[model samples]
Target chain A: MEKQDQILMKKQNKTYVLELIKNMAPISRMQISKNTKMSPTSITRIVGELQEQGFVKETKLVTSGVGRKATLLDVCGDVLFTIGVELDKAVLKIGIVNYVGGMIDLQTYVRNPLESYEETVQNINDKVKNIIEQNAIPVGKIIGLAVGLPGSIDYENGIVRVAEQLRWKDVHLVRDLSKLTSLNVVIDNELKMKIIAENTVGKAKDSKSSILVGIGSGIGSAILLNGEVHRGESNNAGEIGHTVIDPNGNVCSCGKFGCLCTYISEGAILADAKKMKDISSIDEVFVAFRDGESWALNILDRTATYIALAISNLACLYEPECIILSGNLIDKMPEMKQQIEEKCERYMWEPIKKNLHIVHSSLGSQGVVLGAAIQAQNSLFDIN
Target chain B: MEKQDQILMKKQNKTYVLELIKNMAPISRMQISKNTKMSPTSITRIVGELQEQGFVKETKLVTSGVGRKATLLDVCGDVLFTIGVELDKAVLKIGIVNYVGGMIDLQTYVRNPLESYEETVQNINDKVKNIIEQNAIPVGKIIGLAVGLPGSIDYENGIVRVAEQLRWKDVHLVRDLSKLTSLNVVIDNELKMKIIAENTVGKAKDSKSSILVGIGSGIGSAILLNGEVHRGESNNAGEIGHTVIDPNGNVCSCGKFGCLCTYISEGAILADAKKMKDISSIDEVFVAFRDGESWALNILDRTATYIALAISNLACLYEPECIILSGNLIDKMPEMKQQIEEKCERYMWEPIKKNLHIVHSSLGSQGVVLGAAIQAQNSLFDIN
Candidate 1:
């Protein structure tokens, strides 16, 4: 146990130094020692290990205040890679992401909505192999693999408890993937991964805490507090879609009435739009609204109001620095930003709203993949 | 910066040793070192500091595996004291709590609702001074003071941003209290302090994470995630009262429509009861219900449903191990628990609800004061 504690401390110090160099490139080892308050000996030892691992690199020297030349350090972003996979009902996105969360290669594949979890896992294994062989990447450079999907995921056990869209229940994602692949395996909720991407490399890069609200097939949110995912007990903290909005409103797929998702989700909007005209997709509804159809306008206007209410509720609950709008609805219909912000002005509580920013997701289609890869790297990276 | 970091590390190590001794007393220093994986020298140094501070004392000796008698160590609960203040619009509760959260002394005074912040602070100063004089405690033994009240608080700055019940806005609680009291001061939301007490010594003592729901004059919740308050951007994360539950419902005091508090809070229930008959307090409505008044039963039953709904919403959002119901309503009306539980069974989402326990607070009225005092101890206690 004592040895484990020492190892943890060593790893923490090493990660801290690597992150510092990654964030503040061309910084000297003395600067890192000063910033972290680690001894110069400790800094040298950790930096030596990082360099051996091909993570840290010495750049050109800069003259110090006393005219002494000091060598600056930076991280080699391409020295490590992690595989990120986004599993959805109709599509699967796979990518190889570098140490710095940059996507080196990405591929999208159409998935049969009725495919079994086993078949999906097999497909993921095959695709990962293809990506590796095609890129001719050394096996030692790849850290691990992570899959992001929608559902109440038991991240600890890597089980998809229930993903309604994927029609999966109690799927042993990590166990199956581990059996098929040599790399480490991890799985998390899609929104959680999206928030990670936003926090690390996207819109919420400067935020200490943020919430990502996904509003596509279903609505869900993920919270990042002080750089850690606020996974509630059972890793199901941000299932805001199931939160009752109105006791007497429409029944949700979760058997609850007036859940937030039932009113503002893509499926719900399409369903509401079909009541007025023969529309099967959210895009068609927007097209009809663009043509000034009163029913379409009514559906969208009501959707914006409920979206604002959802934001207001989240603000009341989490009070995060920012709430990034994401998923197909926000990503595709960028014009809705103005309406949502306008309604937020009326719906949001005054106190918490003062410092809150309602922003769009900077990562478009790459959020889940990039975030999942970063998560894999985070979980598997070790200083030995 | 380097020296500061070393000091922080040393303090952390000392705190860890002290906490271990407090939790697992009657164990030798060898066992503590084994458990913490700290060196014998480091453990001895920390223990010696704690001993000099009067926090730790040697207990009876026990034979070790090597046949040598080892002296066991334990924490002294009465070595230090902190003042806990629960300030409400109509009442002011002050108490001197010991290190282990035992109430050494307590006092309650009637506070006029129209009193200014300065007047309240002065009253608190006088009351605290009186308690200290009455107890005849040494000045060096006292740690500091902490105040817990309702509504939004900027805890970092010790400012009461807006507490509707107290009609306070932008009131510098810590500054005013500091001007009168010689001790250091801290302040937080009432529910936040209540949950701290619960997490430390009450119903949630064994819980890794818990939520406290205060359902009295208004409804609010405090979340403890891994033993830390999940204070959001403004230390106002759990303001469930302002969360809009119904888009077309009654207006809340915050000018919001259909907030959860507008349905289940004590004031809301009393106002609702008055629709059927003249009612002055919540007790009258319960009396009418006991007498089989249909209107009274209807009102109470609906209140139970919304209370359940509020729990469901919280459960969906937090997925905490347990949600402790407290404040005047839950404490005074134990009979309503069964109804609330039944409604919870019907309202709560299945996946997240399975492991969640809905329990009543055990600390009674001493909760806020004990919590505040402990918080003060946490913030002010130092190992020099």
Candidate 2:
């Protein structure tokens, strides 16, 4: 056969294998034949080829059926790995994940290379190389790289239009990273990653429409509707931090007065905490509040109220199933869960509020990393 | 062939003919054959059957490609009609629409029959009959009936759960309406209809993610994401009007304080306007403002500001291609076009605000009617 013929056959095989895995994973050859509308001989041949490629493995036999016991074909978790990097202004977090979404390695570094976009890209490239070499991981095993940044990203163009934390504007992060590593690179806004994480693994798994609230130094959110992330016209949807909750309260970084983030973010709580005394971090404030510190308690309550208001407004607009609250503040002070839930109940519409669930994120800080890895895997599957 | 086999073939032909009309309307039979992947002989046979059933007709011929002129096979709009009814607490609007989405007749009544759920449904049934009879439309030509109401609707069950305006709880609207009319009845929330309208013919026609703002006596919204209406897990999405924009503002009907609707709804504006002077309608208030009435201007300006804030928040969360302003207020004050766009500019992110186009609804009051008709058509297509 010619090279073109081989390519066509391979493409056809890939499609068949993908459909088989999606529908009948942990299924035997006999079951695949019945389900996939493929002949038993063709199924065996494809399975053999997939096994050789380390994409599928034969598990123990099932004994429930009347016919002969059959070995089940399952996805090989170790066949490939992908790197997921989430770059915030103050810290850079990276995770190496396998095909089944299990994190093989995770690391976080506190560094600010904001003044220069090139330096930041170089730093990420160096770190990725060092991690792979230190682990002695095979280069061929690594599939691709995905990054989530805090800004408006043009996923199609692979450009970061403006990230407030990084103070970068119109940076072609994907092109730079792709050139440095010679691997496919994907980037999107952090909020979109948050939503994707929740949709894939967190509280939003069962929800068709949901909103994931990321309350850290600044507020951001990801809106998932109808089982897909809702990316607005320019891929800048889910930028809820700038919504004005109080028109006369405080000026925001976006030069807006009384934005929601100015009242509910970690920065907001820290600012209020500073009025009483010098509070070093949001974690410290949460700890003090837990210890019955009046000032800290008052500040947390105020922040919770604002957050509740924002959530209620989101509910009214999108009518999502549940709002998953995550980020540095929630991760640090899980005890604030009751306070936030109660406030949402008070603020949201009575009918919608009755049906609403304010749940904490299960994946916590790993949400973005895992989501990025899944996104990269999806791209690979599309290529195949 | 057996009778069943003949029926199945007819159904298949009907579907094929519908698809051909949808894609190649105002097209010749020869063109349809090329587009549908069907043989020219089959296309002719199907077109002949469709013409006999009053579903299609031959129009003028056109010369093309140096070939003989071909007569066009077009949908006969007068052969079938759909009835669309929009029922609110204070008013009822009905329309008769043909296959091409053209309205044959429209009527409005302000009676507030919602005090009794059974009576309201009975009234609708009676009105539907009278309208059909008055127009001398044959009952057999009516394909289906669609109604857009307020509140959360179980589309599958046709149950209305807690429609505040109707003062009804968990009424089996579809079942009840089916008993009154032989035609298939479909019911959904008004916002969902707005979304359907926008997707089918409004500003969202070409864009995948779009938001529709309905500023009537009550403010609400409908969202279209990824080319589908985002109905959340429980069919209660797009309730943006109930979101709390101001914590200390006014108590809303939903028992929330400072919801977006409490500040920006036409009713809210009218309430404020009434306190300043005796006004008969929203149009009167707009007129008063135009005549330099300070109080009216103040109320309208404040209302516009709240609307702008809500739009900004929606932009941040959804980043839609365009946010359409529709419903009663838009019809009353066309000047809101400039006010909303200007205010949105101040609150939205630079990239998003720069590209955002805030436009008045092109469908006007007929939006819900056309939307309902489209909804009925979707049900027909949904038959697997």
RMSD of each: 4.4, 3.2
**How good is the docking of model 2, as DockQ?**
0.62
- TM-score winner: 2
Runs in model 2 with CA error above 4 Å? Answer: A1-12, A15-27, A58-75, A113-115, A199-201, A205-207, A381-384, B1-10, B62-65, B112-115, B380-384
lDDT of 2 by residue, B84-122 (tens): 889887888888888777788888888664358888888
| Model 1 TM-score, 2 decimals | 0.87
Tens digit of lDDT per residue, candidate 1, span A1-384? 699998897788888888898998889988999999999999999899889989999887684688678888888988989999998888899999988778999999999989988899999999999998898889889989999999999999889999999999998989999899878999999999988888788988877889899988788999888888888888999889999889889987777789898898778898888888876778898888889899988888888888888899989988899999988887777778899999999888999889899998978888999999988988888756
TM-score of chain B of 2: 0.91
lDDT of 1: 0.88
Model 1: pairs clashing at backbone N, Cα or C within 3 Å: none
* Model 2 TM-score (2 dp): 0.92
Total backbone collisions, model 2: 5
User: In order, how many clashes per candidate?
Assistant: 0, 5
